[model samples]
Target: MTPPPPAEPVAAMVRPASRYRDSKVNRDLLGVMKGTSIGYWALLGLCVLMVHVAGGIWVYQVYKGLGIAGYAHPVFWGAYIVTFVFWVGIAHAGTLISAILFLFRAKWRNSINRSAEAMTVFAVLTAAQFLGIHVGRMWKSYFILPYPNQRGLWINFKSPLMWDTFAISTYATISIVFLFIGLIPDLAIARDRARGFRKGLYAALSLGWQGTTNQWKAHNRTVLHLSGLATPLVLSVHSVVSWDFAVAIVPGWHSTIFAPYFVAGAIFSGFAMVLTVMIPVRRIFRLEAYITDYHFENMSRFILLTSIIVGYAYLAEFWTAWYSGVEAEQSAFWLRAFGPYWISSWVMIIFNGVLPHILWFKKVRTHVPTLFVLSVCINIGMWFERYVIIISGLSREYVPAVWGTFTISWAELGIVGGSFAFFSMFFLIFLKLFPIIAIAEVKEIAIHERAHAEEGAH
Candidate 1:
């Protein structure tokens, strides 16, 4: 009789969905949406101030002319071009990790994909700024676009710049769409929890998403289609970027291997950037449970793999230069290692090629502090890599008389600093506004784990 009485409540017999919904992971992540701290505001203000400094420098340069920013005879493509290529390369890691890994069903990516995708979008935006700065006449920059004009001048279809324009624009558009599609379900969650204008905004962004089985099925199909489309862009955008240099007949630039070389370098720096951004984010947001040591180790392994590829590309370049018996090519390669910009070239080799091997040690990979420092060094090395490629190639051309050296002026330095500030500003704002981690995906994982636990109990 007592046993029968205790069997009373069906609610107690079956677990309520809320039990799974209010998981520790869900609660912890949702807490980030609550409000920001003083540190966030302080960092945001510092970023804004840095951006203003950059804007002031740009204003001064525009008024004072391009002379103020260190443009010269042979080295016209100085820091701006290097920074552009570096940022473009940085953009690759995001799409590769988010879209390609998604298509492969790499479950580990679920923790960091949102942040990586956001980084992709912002990096592209930052990279676009360099094009305007490099144009000198920023006002007439729109001329690069393919449109019917009164002057009857059209963009050259055969030009690599035209290809770059198309590739970057298309990649940015698809990336934005892919990022938004993934955000919809999470937006719905935010919409439900928020109040006032914030709620309405998220509601609009979420597009009336009600979590039904059919809706989820459609969502899954859409994601698969987008992922399939984005995967090639991950490869093509950076490869096309490499072609900007590769198509050139310059001794250092023209090589059949440049495409893969640039692609590998892009991935190398991109993962470094992800580590730079995510390490701090995971700590600040207390996302340790979600973005665990395991995630960091996985990324470290990726960094190690890309490092090896890049190292091979470097050796291959040297081998090609020496084996071809082309005096100019050999000279360019040797000059890169031991010429005027020798310091920068060796720095690139040591930081990008050699330093990352430290990640092979499990302790370095697992320790956040060590990984962060290594990641920063890798990014620095990557920038130097671009510098060596652009400056070294043009600095000592076949005709040494026409060759010249370039130094980055204060204005250009400000712009480079500003680009970093801008990227950080946007990413920080994104962290505060959106669920930085994917809540719905975390819930799905929790549900899967719980189901497995029940099966084991049986």
Candidate 2:
């Protein structure tokens, strides 16, 4: 038969860079976008219920008084302020992972940066609520803004509170813009695959993107510029927050070290919150291939580094207090370590400082359950850190007569719980509405990997 007419040489199959096919990627991710599990609905309903409870509590407080909560003499800044600082600190991790890491060209960030950036935006929103709540007169909260009004009133530019107003609003605005900008290509992907109202929603949100080369080029440039702008804001926002205390003349509050100390703790807690959110997300979405052990390992290392920094800050605070020879400062430091709130102080140390050392072990770093539990502990510890710094500093003034004890009330606890629910609710809604992963970016990485593989194959 003439050797089957000299059959043509079989073509070699080209392997894709990533294990996933583009169509499969779209299908898998779109599966996340399209449907909701009963569990998801149940969790969302629970969050909504908690949020309503919080709102009702806030309304009750508004009608009754701030006294219903825990605002008393010497402890004017209570659970609300502590929650605000904690949430604001939690916001820092997203910017650090997304903007700072992006600027450094960390490829590993591609998997988690989308969620981190979203967390930053929503955490800031959650943090903002406390400002109004703490002010007690939510209606008069607008007075903090500088505007041309019939009555001549202006924001005090020199006040740290004023600076915080600018800092947080600026951070929120820039973060939202950065998030929206980064999301365009993925939004386009969603737009292409979706139908009905979903298609139109994504189409509008995508801002007329057509995936042209020019569009990508412009998108990249904008991202770079925004990242540069955002990186400094991350440092500045928390620094300004620290100033809210550092500028005061309280025994523990006034210190030059507060800025860096607060910044480090912010990043520390922020990473913990990231871990808290991402571990469950990765599990639920069945995205183990995308969010692999490598990412968790790197994050654990980051947590370890921040833990060391925070521990140093803690020691430095004591050293500074002792070194300064200021009796009030010394008394404040002693009280923090051994006073009535000693349990909280030690809890902060154990959780933020000691427990994170477990991440130094490779096995612990790679273990998701351990990491999740550690992250939750870190979050709790960070909250207590804020409580120690704010309430402790304020409670023990030089005047012994004015010294008082503060306790969180049921209303405050309800509000705090509600804030968690609000944050979770918004994040869940985001997952439902958008691609949790950056489809274009992930595909781009895959293409680069494939190119390298093909070159090596030759």
Candidate 3:
């Protein structure tokens, strides 16, 4: 009897039928939904502190009026406009990744597009903030909008600034919608993994996704359509932003090359910013398996491509000025290259045009430390490029009699630092709340691989 009793039942391994044949994807991505890293908390706290300090500085500037911004006569658009353009350029990489690369069926984008799209939204919001700050009266900022109000004002549809308002808003709306659509299934996965308050939030955001065949079909179709719609915006939005300068009667600002030149520069800097942010994210989050050296190499190739184009643009600017026989254009550019802002011009040329050549070497492109340093250098140079473009042109202009030097005020500098921190803060929160990698897309790659293997066996 004791021997019979000892023959207890062996536990059966009853895995669920609907479960993914490979569950590692879910385990790896969903693991991030729980637990906060100490490093993450430290970084988040630092960003929040920086943001608060920036906010206080902005308040002081607001209270004191535009005088505190260190704006001289003709140099009205100084750091504020430079910072604005820098962020607008920052926003371009996302649209390029999510929309253009998707059209080309670039699978490398799958690992990075989620974060790229989020970056675009945050950058747009940051850039919009400067418009108000630049206006000097945050209260009357609504005047920038095109709406007809009770105060007998007509919308100037012809204004290039208005064009900026339309382009950026539309770009933001589409980007948010595109990001949300992509997030649905990923949120559902997070919802199932999360508990308590986060569970409820994800469940609502995921909209009851059950991974039905019809739901997937709809998602694929919708993504394709939206990708097509977003494709043109990549070029148009930045072209309109360039018009803000090109349409101006400013000497160096008015050039036919401005549109393509600005677009190339935008993507050049945007890709650099992406690399800068993602390299840190990849290291911190342990996403090397997803965001491998392969992805980084491909991104570096783009940096090289855009950099060559940008360098050509630099030479072309001087060429056009010399060839066109326009004294104003020649003078503005001369001042840019050889005048007081020569430091920024050389920094822009050397950092953006010269340094990117290192990416031509496979070893440098694939090397993490070198790539990261190059990215940071590219960012600094891009900032300096805008500085030279705006301040250099505005510094000497056609009338040297009205010329004045624009110093980078502490308030302006603080706000720029804060903008970076602000973007980092939201991105940090996003890492915890959502699946940083697109789980569904990655698993689809696995499923296809398995199916091909099985078919080959058969």
Locate the minimum summed-lDDT window of 10 residues in model 1: 1-10
How high is the CA lDDT of each candidate model? 0.90, 0.91, 0.88
**Number of the top-ranking candidate, with lDDT as the measure:** 2
- Tell me the lDDT of candidate 2: 0.91
Error of 2 at 110 (Å): 0.2
Taking the tens digit of each residue's C-alpha lDDT, what string does model 3 give over 337-396?
Answer: 888888899999999999999999999999999999999999999989899989988888
lDDT of 1: 0.90
RMSD in angstroms between candidate 3 and the native structure over all alpha carbons = 4.8
Residue-level lDDT tens digits of model 1 in 231-307: 88888998899999999999989998999899999999999999999999888878888999999999999999999
For every candidate in turn, the CA RMSD to the true structure comes to: 3.3, 4.9, 4.8
Provide the lDDT at 84 for model 1. 97
Angstrom error of the Cα, residue 372, model 1: value is: 0.8
Cα misplacement distance, residue 456 of candidate 1 (Å): 1.2
Error of 3 at 78 (Å): 1.2
Question: Could you give me the TM-score of model 3 versus the true structure?
Answer: 0.94
Candidates sorted by lDDT, descending order? 2, 1, 3
